[model samples]
Target chain A: MNSRLQAWLLALPATFFVVVCLGLPVLSTLATTFGEPAGPFVTYIQFFTSGFRRAVLLRTIEVAVITTAISLVVGFATAWVVARSPGRIKSILIIAAVFPLLTSVVVRSFAWMVILGKNGIINKALLALGILNEPLSMLYTEGSVIVAMVYLFVPLMILTLVGVLEGIPQDLTDAAASLGAPPSAAFRQVVLPMAVPGLIVGAVLVFTGSFTSYATPQLLGGDRQTMMGTFLYQRAMVTFDWVGASTIAAVMVVVTIATVLLMSRLARKLNPVVG
Target chain B: MKTRIHPALIAFSVFTFVFLIGPLIIIIGTAVSDTTFLTFPPQGFSMRWFANIFEVSAFPRTMVTSFTLAVLATTLSLMVGVPAAYALARFRIELPKFLANVFVLPILVPEIVLGFSLLKSVATGVGASIWTSLLIGHALLVLPYCVRVVGASLNSFDFSVEEAAVSLGCPRWKAFFVVVLPNIRAGVIAAFILAFITSINDVSVSIFLTGPGISTLPIQLLAHMEQFFDPTIAAVSVLLMGVTVAVMTVVEWTLGLTFLTK
Candidate 1:
């Protein structure tokens, strides 16, 4: 066969898979938004106008931002430690970081329930210490959701940053030190600026992961805080409002894509190498 | 050549590691507990909860369904993704960026959105079964991973040997199967394992695609937890964790952990 024909022939199978399975479905879902009983713009209008949905959207953004910020800070520290460690210790730490990601989200979320439940570990200890008269209601709250999400996603940020941190030569820091720059100053001026790309990439991953995650918010937040994912679920499955659900789903996709673009642009502007 | 990790950083790292793995250790601990209610540090130990998994009829069946689906999805994705990766990597193709992005877009899209979209499409069809929906969904989900890993191997591959074989009157197809496939075999295998794990662990997409009387392992476990709130789910979680750890070990051995970060 001619190489072009051969190439298309080779690519046909996967292209068909994406087109039929993903492209068609996503387009159809977007199409459904226009067919809503109220009107074409009704679902979108209601979504933006409704206080409850606006709150959910804002809460999702808030939780995702906080989770990303916290994950980046903690993950950066973990990655720095792992990157600087000797071989055996490095392997152990890296494995510890990646191992949690191998388990199911349900499994991890359930694990958090055991740890953060009303009569769970922390509460049990607090009660034992006589810090409270009764077990505190920790589970099924926004705080629980954030904690569980950070636990679930921090590993990703760490993995991302570790690669970047490892790529930096030791001489750069040593040069700064020889010039009388303190350890903290070297990190702030030389290391942190160089790590911006990884930071941006990690932030995007953590933010999007936390924002779009359904299982974490569902089980941990319970019915208390309805994030976008949970709200989309209830609207689609429980209420059978596919049109309204599609509207939410489309909005989420747009927001996520926009965030990715924005973050990368910001990264490029901040990092001369990328720009 | 010489450096020391800061003491405070080491402390923080230890805490982070503990925070990441502690919940899982607690889950395993809870699974081994003899008590009915869930507890982190068990009062006593027994294998009853582990054995209790078999008592739940739906659990085993759902597990079988999930395993079958994962296997089928992984196989199908390899079949589709390998050739596509080859074309994208080797062919002097136009619009390569857009085509590659199309293959990878599923991962970029949120699972909740993907699931909802797939559900809408499946709903419009005439009497589609849950299995068909799930298989299609999962295959789409894992296709990107297959392409990615395979594409990476193909990128750094020496194309001269294949061309040399072709110059010696060897057919193109034979060159691919006899030479190209063997070299990229490790990448293909890594992709297969990653895809299988992804398919097995998926709950968000599965939740929407699953129909009456059909559920994946995660969904089944989630439903069971909603009602029971016992150690049985913990037992199941441990078993699932064991399988994942084993799969990840294979991935680490074959492809190395750095392959994922890259």
Candidate 2:
């Protein structure tokens, strides 16, 4: 066979699979929204105008933003400290940091239920302290949802930031310190600025992860809260409204693409050198 | 240059590590608890729950189904992904960037969207069976990883080795099978293991794709949680966590965990 034909033959199976499995389904779902009672643009109109969906959309974005912000700050500090630790300690610390990401999200969510439930660890500790007359209601709340999400995704942020932190030279920080800057100033002026690309990448990942996550909020948020993910599940599975589900799914894709574009553009403006 | 360790940084790191690991620790503790109701810091200790998993018929059935799905998905993904990676690595083919991005679109797209979309298509008869739907969904999700890991390995390999084999009168296909394949064995193996683990632990896409009378382990566990809150799920979760740690340890020992971290 000729070289071009050989490459095509080699590529055929994956191409076929992607088209059949991914491309067609995604396109068809997006196409389905254009049909049915509400029709294409009308469904988008109704969805945005409706109070319940609008709140779910806003709440999803709000949770994602908070989760990403907390994950980034905590991740940056953890990554910095892990990067600075000595040999064996550093290796162990890195292993410990990433240990959570290896396990299933289902497992992680289940564990969080035990810790945050009414008679769970945190409430038990508080009751023991005599800080409250009764067990504080911690589980099935919006705060628990955020806590679960932040806990689930912070390790990812740390892993991303660690890679960036490792890339920076020690001499730059030392140079800043020698110029009468304290450790904090050196970190803020030299290290933080250099890690912008990592921050941008990590931020997009954590935000997208939190936004699309179904299990964390489902188990922790209880009946009172409904994020976009659970909302999508309910629309498609519970209500059997394929059109509404497809529209929501499409909106998620658009929002994710928008966030990535916005973040990358912002990163480019902040530091033209990296890209 | 001398560097000083900040006490505050150490404290913060310690606290973060605890937060990350504290939940899993609680699950393990709950597994061995003597009392029920998902209590932590157990009233006493027992292995009864671990043995109790066998009494639950759905648990074992779901375990078998999940393992079978993961294995099949891994095999199919590798079959599709390996040659695709080879083509991408070897030739400056047409729409090269586009092809690369197409393989990667699965990662960029929200998985919940993917699941919902696939659910609609399957219901409308895009796929012939629920088994096929779940398999296709899983294989697509793990497809990017297979291409990525194998492609990275291919990039680091010397193309001239295969060229030398072809020049020495070896047929093109034989050159790939006998000469090139052996060299990239580590990458192929790593890709397979990674794909298998991903398929096994996956819940998001499988949640929508699962059908009547067939459920993956995660889905079964989720369904179980909806009705009953007990140590049985914790015991199962602890076992699953053990399996994950074992698989990841193998990956780390063999490939340095960079495939995951990167």
Task: Give the best candidate by TM-score.
Answer: 1
Residue-by-residue lDDT tens digits, candidate 2, A1-275: 67888888888899988887788888888887778664559889988999999999999999999999999999998998877777688777777766788788999998888898888888888888998779878887888999999999998998898878878889888889889998788877788889998999999999999999998888998668899999989988999887889989988989998998999898998783654
Judged by whole-model lDDT over C-alpha atoms, candidate 2 comes out at 0.87
Model 2 interface RMSD, one decimal? 1.5
Give the per-residue Cα lDDT of candidate 1 at B85: 93
Per-candidate local distance difference test: 0.89, 0.87
DockQ of 1: 0.76
For model 2 chain B, where is the 10-residue window of minimal lDDT? Answer: B253-262
Best by lDDT: 1
Interface RMSD of each: 1.3, 1.5
In terms of docking quality, model 2 is medium
- In candidate 1 chain B, what residue range of length 10 has the lowest lDDT sum? B120-129
Q: How does model 2 score by TM-score?
A: 0.96
Residues B1-262 of candidate 2: C-alpha lDDT, one tens digit per residue? 7666688888998999999888889999999999877887886999888888888888999899999998999899999899999998998654357887778888888999998888877645655578888888899999998999999889988989999999999998899889888988888888887888888888889889898888999999999999988899999998898877887787777677645556
Per-residue error (Å), model 2, residue A169? 1.3
True contacts kept of 2: 0.67
